[model samples]
Target chain A: MKHDYYPPGIKGIDGDYTAALAGNPNTGKSTVFNALTGLNQHTGNWPGKTVTQARGYYRHRGKTAVIVDLPGTYSLSANSLEEEVARDFICFAQPEVTVVMADATCLERNLNLVLQILEITPKVVVCLNLMDEAERKGLKLDVDQLADELGVPVVPTAAHIGRGIAELKDKIHSVAVSEILPRPKPVTYSQQLEEAIRQLETSLQRVYTNGISRRWIALRLLEGDHSVIEAIREYSLAEGKGAE
Target chain B: MGVDAALNLDELIEHGRELRNKLGPETEIQDEIVTSIYRRAEAIASKVAAQAGGRGRDWNKTIDDLLTSRLVGFPLMLLLLGGILWLTISGANYPSNALAALFFMLEDKLTFLFLRWQTPEWLHGLVVLGTFRCLAWVVSVMLPPMAIFFPLFTLLEDLGYLPRVAFNLDNIFKRCGAHGKQALTMAMGFGCNAAGVMAARIIDSPRERMIAILTNNFIPCNGRFPLLISMAVLFLGAGGLKYGSAIASLTVAGMVLLGIGVTFLVSYVLSSTMLKGISSSFTLELPPYRRPQVLQVLVRSVLDRTLFVLWRAVKVAAPAGALVWVLANTNIGGMSIIEHLAGYLDPAGRLIGLDGFILLAFILGLPANEIVIPTLLMSYLGAGALLELESLSAMRELLLARGWTWLTALNVMVFSVLHFPCGTTLLTIKHETGGWKWTIIAVLLTTGTAFLACLLITQVVQTLGLLF
Candidate 1:
């Protein structure tokens, strides 16, 4: 019942801020990771190119940050291991900044994951990657408008060509240090589901005291996420033992 | 406090379950959530994005139509595969011969040095004749084709054609109750089976992934290519064909197609019986094509794939060469150990249309497939060391002198395609599956199929001969 979702091989350092790179598959997520960390992770032009979570470290503004590249998933549904892994890391490890990368060419499909991530955490940055490909395909994105709409910093990057990387790093640093506060717009569910989530959240507040949103936990529990239920039970027991 | 906390948590979970039941099935709730998210994404995208032109989009659509169309997809895939094989075989011949000459020259110099220094005969034989010769053969035979083939394969992958291949074959795989992504792994197997096994991790379902790993060995890898091509040229092309090399290329390509056929057949059988499960659906995105970076492809393929596989083959082949030499030289009872073992196995080998030397070579070539032909040639000549014939004609003459017919060549090619995977691949299977149980199953499955296929083919050919 231990909450040990971070893959065993990767351990975050004491002073290093942790960032998780989340994206749809083939949105150049790995490319951005390699560019930021200077690590030679293999980048392939295919979906599900990264099946495992790879961790690398990068230094910015005299502070070293550990970056974990999560597997690409379209949604946080427990339909596959990738979705589960990406969901668990974001909810449990709670990396200081979660960079949600999206493809500029197909912004709508990519935005689904961004909306799901925003529901879980406010410390999110939308990286619109493949701007070059998007332009070539005759598509244009208003970066500032996207940022304003989502209530988070949106950096338009062509990670393959190393454009907008500096701005991405700066945003990640500010968010990690609590200098930039992002209040993400939460997705509104059905009124009936919302009523159920509120009731469950109030009942669970007595036992759950982590900084994670109780409403999100309530939603996941209502959705029958067995892992989330188990995580909550473990956290409650640990807290009780500490008090005893 | 702990007991109270545990009770409260259980109560909350129970409450959550009751709520979930009230909401109906998990899928319906999931559908609602996904639809809402998609709707929101659409709204936001509409508000922020605009299209300016359609040139690149049109270009990709046209290419995808030609490549993935039902009528032309299969034929185009085969044509591209055959073209690559033809190029690899034709381009590799000159460099392979040149490399062989250069390595043999070095071998002669090493022999002279040993003689000049009063080195012992057995020592000279072990070092120069046994280990060095085998290493030289593996390098010369493997390097050029890999050097040419890996880049070409990487170029296609870079051009994003591989996904289209998966797209073309997805329905067929679905019918076989396997994942469509298995096509990508099978393509990787053409380069190396171990890599193909590793690539199976991309498949989401555990059941389908196992199917991919188990059947990957049916595809002929780079190591088996030299043997398959040589046999095809010597046997199939020699049958009064004017366009010999072209016919040989077609024959080799046919062998590849057969491997793919066997893969699907095995996948179907396994899915129906041992690894029974419904194939899970996945969204395979066909990315837009991009012009491959020629310099990057060359550098990455040579460094990452070609060198890596060649290094592994050489590491195993060196010790295997020494072992083969010892077996060929040390007499058991007036006959060397190699001859004695082959004699004992000759009956079974003949029953399957292969001779004892061919079977012995396969057994000894467990560590690496590239050494199979060299081992067979050395054993047949009783050379007590690995040897390489100068040309394809010389190899054909040697085999013909030793009672090889077209039947032998055909059986050898068939057996090589269907046999147990090499040692590295078996180890990889074990590692990927996380147990020895699946690895043993993979071995028994492939080896059993190989034996059965060879037996059936041999019987059919003999029956036809009697009829004629």
Candidate 2:
């Protein structure tokens, strides 16, 4: 009751605002966290190196924000602990600005998680890391066009070498304070699935009083993801108990 | 849509559960959701990203092909490991001797100061000889090799070569009926067995995870490396400079190879019998190798690994040193406590090609494998008076004075590689496996394998010697 599923006992993610970092593995997510927090969280070129979440704090534009680095997960399917941890923090904790870090060299694979997170929340900032690597490889992403396409802020960064960091913080600061509101145009499913989600969202919204997006919850319910439903159920019970 | 304030938590769960069924009885909603998400991602990517020459990944594929190729892979892995071990051994020699000389010189100064203060013999002996000597040796012997080895190892890890190792070993793991991810955990075990056991969570199958946990100790961790290196240098490398260093590295490499071989053997045996399972295939994506952060890696690893490991060894060895002094100095009916204990265990230890002091050290080093040689040296300090302790030759002299043969050194190396996991690792196993039963089985499996291996080796060697 006292907490919203931030995966309890995670220290230092309580500030004026909170941002959660999510991405596919080896996408420079932790490097971005270090570049912001100035903390040397281990960054190795190994998947699952970060088996658990790490939390850090940063101050930008006179606003001190707590940044939680969720474990690198491929999807919100919750097939593994990494996925479950990333999903719960995003769905329940609902940080103000969610930075979906993506690899600039292979934007397509990284965008899978970015799109998934967009469905769950509106304020998404796509931190396109490894821009230098991308450039050396003769590849580049049109950052503004990416922003326009995804309906969010896309900040190009060679985060390891500290380029584009200032702009990233500026975007994060504005988004957290709602100056740059991200009305994310998330994925639309088939007609039958959309109809099912609409029917579920109508009934589910009444039971869910939190800031959680109703359509996202409906999609998850239809998909039979037990962890998401179980966590939301418990959160609602606590809310109901606290209300009474 | 907004009139459900009266509904309670129980109703919410019941509604959600029943609602899952209302989605037309599994009409591929999950598949559709996933497909649409990926499709959306692809759509955005097409619009925003400019295509590269598309040959960026070709270099990575070329390297991965050579590294994992059946013809060149295993040999290259062996050479790299052997070269690293060679470098660690060669690089460690001067620094170890210098530190040993420095610490022993300080020990003499501390001894003079203790005598000037008119401290009693037991007090001076405990402080200067037992505790200080162990701390000095642990630092001098343990720090340099780790300082060199770990940075290089971290360089490889950072350069994205470790996963390629796992990739190369996948087929062997598959043949063993264990998950290929076991290779990843086994690679982790080279750093620390406790950490390696924890890394087993990546393996999805419970049976394969158990196999990884039980067999992890076979890959000698950081704690065992110093012992293996010192033994190899002194005993196997007695032939002088050129051949000597090469042989030393080869012996250490050989021991490492044997440890790995035993890992696969034990994994295979377990998977076929007690813990049966099909080896599930996995997607092993090799990350593109990046240029390693050389200066940063050196500073980070030396501080994080070298000094940290040295600090731990000092903390543990100091008290263990005092305990060893007490055991070796205290008299019971004219025989020291260590002598009595060693005497009781002497026959068993002898049959396994080790002395009782060595066996006692292994037992005492249960908390950590790093402390075994420190405790043994401390025991020697009590037993052998006025003997110097510095350098490989001096260490060899000390061992030679205490009646150690080449066979003793070889068998000690053998036993060190195969013994039970350290206490911290056992505790980690308990946490990972969630019970005492598997932990107990782990102990028996490792120690049982060790005792049998050493016994067979010693018996065979000695019989061969007599006939020759």
Candidate 3:
């Protein structure tokens, strides 16, 4: 967690669990990472360019954990490099728990990302951040209600002031230990599109054993997301490759 | 079941595509996906979050207004910039002098050690006089100001004022027929031009993006910042007393203002000529200001800028020192190799109000802008490179002894501002633009501007002096 030494390569990183932090720009996603992992990330620059990946580790509850701070992005649309990275890390890197940090002030916009991330992984912990900013702005969020709606554990955190961080860590641990199963509510699509996705998911489940949600893979494939195509190839899971 | 279980991945992808196409063109599948996700988000938020009369919201609007307004904005910007520069200049003097005194004293011990060990002249000259001296100059002269300046600058950045800077400059960029995002890229240039050039990708308009890439060199990066600060302190500054720092800081601020002016002018020219295009507009998000944690600020600044300078000093300046040392020490027909090259370049250099040594140092410094001033000093002091800089005054005396007038100092600062992007930046431009042609154009454009501007200024100023 300290800057004195960053473990290099596979040898240095021996985390009992890997947790991923994802969020929109300026949502204090890094503040969450730094609070949890004590990595002094370059947490400046509005509309920040976190295109580069940064990793840090911290020990929690007698277990060493590594937190990979994904690039800040609005959604996993694979339209930009940041999106591609965030998507690939959650989908392929297969972190034990993915914490989606949402600014409490603008819960709607930030939740859009949480929904998209939910489609990809069931182990998503919604960390509602910037509670102080929201309160100062005269806004209030019902954390329990948000969790109930999303069917996940939503931890309200004023991360900058060290508020709700312990609970966030606890939620991350419980989620990582599979003690708290997050059954995220899925979005419904048009009947025709839904049928297509259903068939694609069935086909995808047979071929894609990469641990990513087959339904999310089906949707991305339907959306002509080339990045997922690249990711699928990069993991070298394509079936025809072994044949030819 | 075995053959079917294989489920050729390519075939599944093909099947997915076929199903997607079957949904028909009217479906707008991506839009539907986005909207569906957003719908779920809105549904969740409406059920959970509540908004009342947002307190302290109007205050943010009021400040942003004054900070970005036409009348009050620019003067305020200049004041903050000048104040930061002034602090860096005045604050760094004692530490720089103390470090210099400490290092030079060590250099003497090193000389005694060489004498005691009976090392050869070439060996001593290369090791102690050349490389070690250059390293000392870089650390003592360059490091302190950077340690002061970068933290201050990063503080502004961390406080989210930099985006406000982009917001203030947006109108001018639009007027220049460049993208509004070029302001952001130029702001990036203040940190590192290679980063700034890479940031040009946000422009999205090819012509405007190219303009941003080419004009990025006009904004001084942190490497050039120390050089400018030292130059201003030498000729234009009053020295490091309180008000003295103010004067020096304002001078450097003035130089930065000049560089920004050049960026706009060049952006205008490029938009009109080679990379002709209308300005593309963008919605710049101005986030509410936040107070950075004080301890975090110190740690982040030291880690980012100060450490980077030290790393660069060792990696780039060490080798530069040995090369310059060899060039200065190697005899060619009774003149050192550096002198001979300088003599050949002297005429051209003089036209631009710089001597051949200065120009040669700049050429040699193309690999790293941080080394230009050090290389110039190493060769200008001749083989000795033994000049001790206890203060700016001592350095001034050395420069004056070499026939340097205030004009030379001014031109050096200006030329440093306009010269070609560093080797890293040039490579970045090549990679970003994806061609050698645009990269070459960028180098030529920036270097040509430096020469022409320096030449014109020297001529006009000298003519005025003559008339008086």
Predicted structure with the largest DockQ when compared to the true one: 1
Screening candidate 3 with a backbone cut-off below 3 angstroms (N, C-alpha, C), the clashing residue pairs are: none
Q: lDDT per model, in order? A: 0.84, 0.84, 0.83
lDDT of 1 at B188: 89
lDDT of 2 by residue, A165-226 (tens): 89999999899999998878868887767877777677775565467788887777777665
For candidate 1, write residues B1-468 as lDDT tens digits.
667767877888888888878877877776777787788889999999987875766777899999999999999999999999888877877888788888888988898999999998988877877788778878887888889989999999999999999999899898899999999999889888999999998898889999999999999998898788778878877655787768878888988998999999999999999999888888788887888999999999999989988898888888877877778778877888999989888998999999888999999998889889877876775543233455556667788888888889888999999999999899999999999999999999999999999999899999889322
- What's the CA error at residue B49 for candidate 1, in Å? 2.0
Question: Which stretches of model 2 miss by more than 4 angstroms?
Answer: A6-17, A34-66, A160-162, A173-224, B1-47, B51-55, B102-120, B174-180, B198-210, B271-285, B384-386, B401-403, B430-438, B463-468
Best-to-worst order by TM-score is: 1, 2, 3
Ranking by lDDT: 1, 2, 3
In model 3 chain B, which range of ten residues has the least summed lDDT? B1-10
Model 2 TM-score relative to the real fold: 0.85
Give model 1's TM-score versus the native structure. Answer: 0.90
- For residues A1-244, what per-residue lDDT tens digits would candidate 1 score against the true structure? 1225444534334436888899998899989999898962332221233455677777899998888788888887756778877876787678899999999988988998999889889999899999988887888779899998899999999998899999999999999999999988877779877788888888887765356777777777787776776765676676566667
